[model samples]
Target: MAKVGGVVAAGFLGLSGLIWFVNLPYPMIRRPVAGIAPMLLLPSYLSMDRNYREAIAHVEQADQLVNQATSAADIGLGAEKVKLAQENLDQLPVWFLGYEPVRMCHFMGCSWNFTFDEFSRARAQVGRMNARIFQENNALTQLQTAETDLQKAKQAYQTATNVSQQQNAIADWQTALDQLTVLPRETLAGTTGATKYRNYERDFNRVVGSVAGSNQTQTMIAAAQQFAALATQNSQKSAYTVTEWQQIETLWSNAIDRLQKVDSTDPDYLAAQSYLADYTQKLGVVKTRLETEEKSTLAIAEAKRQTQELISSLPSKPNPDERNRLISRLQGIIDQLKQVQPNTTVYAEAQTLLKQAQSKLSQL
Candidate 1:
């Protein structure tokens, strides 16, 4: 009887050791998956010691009100708070919140393939092209860098697909999980690579002629506007020095270019045309200013000559009314001259001439 009792105790100890071994690593592995677990699983674990330790903390503060409640009405109020928390939990989609752990693991592995495998090969390919930009921008090697980034973007798209798929698997674990995982991605679709990478690809395709022929005209117009801005800045022409005027022309040209790319009925094209008219009006103002400057210069010259001749023809005392009228006319000319921008050759020359006229007037 003593030996049998000893054997029974030994068997119990061995079983307990096995259970401990299995239970210890389970939580560690499950720790990562805890957030992804479904609402249905919450009730089952609520009775467990480990569950209370891991998750109850998020809702712990609400427990005091629940515990202190003395009536059904108070309990109902406490339950309402718990329901609100559950609703908040639902707001985080299963794809984003539940399956995120599995998705993260999958993405980390996929990222490594692009960085070491695909990117290195793409860089080698661009290296063979002998791209001029590589030399000019000292980024000859950077062509490979861009290709590497492009390849990585493609890989990220693939990883997004896998992450999405893993979320579906997690959802299949429970019906509620399925609803949480599936609904949000269906509503708002997005690809893997960063948004900036997508935009870069769009602008690059337009610039490099990868886009269809229909878009070519718009692309050319955009390029032309860029060139026009460069010309306006560096051109020796005085009227062109007005950067704002050049910008107006650039806007008009860009709008026309963009307009040509789309059907005339397209709203974007119509919007471009509207912007074109606005910039065109601005350019017209610049042209009008230029013309006004030209006319004002001639009027100033004529007024100076007439005043000098009149002064010479007069006796030592000029006619008081005529002298005053000439002075007033001279002052009007100066005011108009002041309105002209000094960047123009006509305005600069006129300013020098006006100073001389003022000196002569002072003598009178």
Candidate 2:
């Protein structure tokens, strides 16, 4: 019975020692993907699932590539590799954060955490991430600059009052659109930025079309205004020859034609219509004045011609009757010229001729 009791005591002690050994806290060589149960069952800490270790190992490989890079051109390739490593780390499940004992914390202070080496390897990719961010920032800046230029062009186009100005601004807008590829990709900055630029492009084209219509109308209005000014100048003249009246007709007609060409949709179309009515009325006034002037001009020319012939035909003898007859004829010519009015352009010349004839009569 004593020997049997001794064997039983030894067996109990051995079982306790085995349990302690299996449950002992061990240091992590690599982070494991397996659950706590498997970590407890496996003899080696790294022997179960090792997906976390593989992901972290990718980060280390990327770091090696980054270290080999010497120039700015090589940095792009290195950043891509680093992004791959980041993708792997992102794929890791949340449960992969592991718990283990290290040399500093033997029994109670230990907790679930990333392995020190794995965390450092993942942290090493931060520089590469920063590089990619900087590249994106530069691209975004260029895009914004180009976008601002496009905005100015669009504004100029919308506000321009003439065809030439609108055309120049539209050309600038086209150039800006051509350079749209300089913008950073949506993957780099975001979809929002790219979407904003696209909206600008759509709005710009719409505004340009409106501007083209407006400018076309403005161009026609300008052309009409030039003709209208000339018509006004000619209409203000107190005297018009038959040829001058014909020229006035041409100017008024051309001005009306241009005004008629103004689009009905134009903002100034109603004003143009009103101008057409006003010009038509003025043209009638000018035509009436021209007819009166033409009749008066013909009468004045006949009287002057008859007076000059009589003055030339006067005898060398200073007979009172002959002199009186010549003076009466000269008075008739002056009376005809007085009807021409001082406001008339030919009236001044007529007055000079009247003064010369009166001097001849006074000498006789």
- For model 2, how big is the CA root-mean-square deviation? 36.6
TM-score of each: 0.28, 0.34
> Which regions of candidate 1 fall more than 4 Å away from where they truly are?
1-215, 218-223, 234-261, 264-285, 288-295, 298-341
Q: Which stretches of model 2 miss by more than 4 angstroms?
A: 1-219, 230-249, 261-268, 281-300, 318-328, 358-364
1-364: candidate 1 lDDT, tens digit per residue: 9999999999999967654443332444334434554232332232232332322332343344354543334444545554543443333222222232334435433212122333334334323222311222232133334445444544443355575653332222222111221121111111112333346545434433322223433444454456446534544455443444555455545444444444464434555465456546655665665455566556556656665665566556659887887677666655655555555546666687668767766865
Model 1: lDDT to the true structure:
0.44
Each model's Cα RMSD = 28.3, 36.6
| Candidate-wise lDDT, in order | 0.44, 0.63
lDDT of 1 at 212: 26
Which tens-of-lDDT digit does each residue in 108-195 have in candidate 2? Answer: 2322246656556565655555565466556556666777878888888779999889789987775665456346453333333566
Residue pairs that clash (backbone atoms under 3 angstroms), model 2: none
Model 1, position 243, has a per-residue lDDT of 48
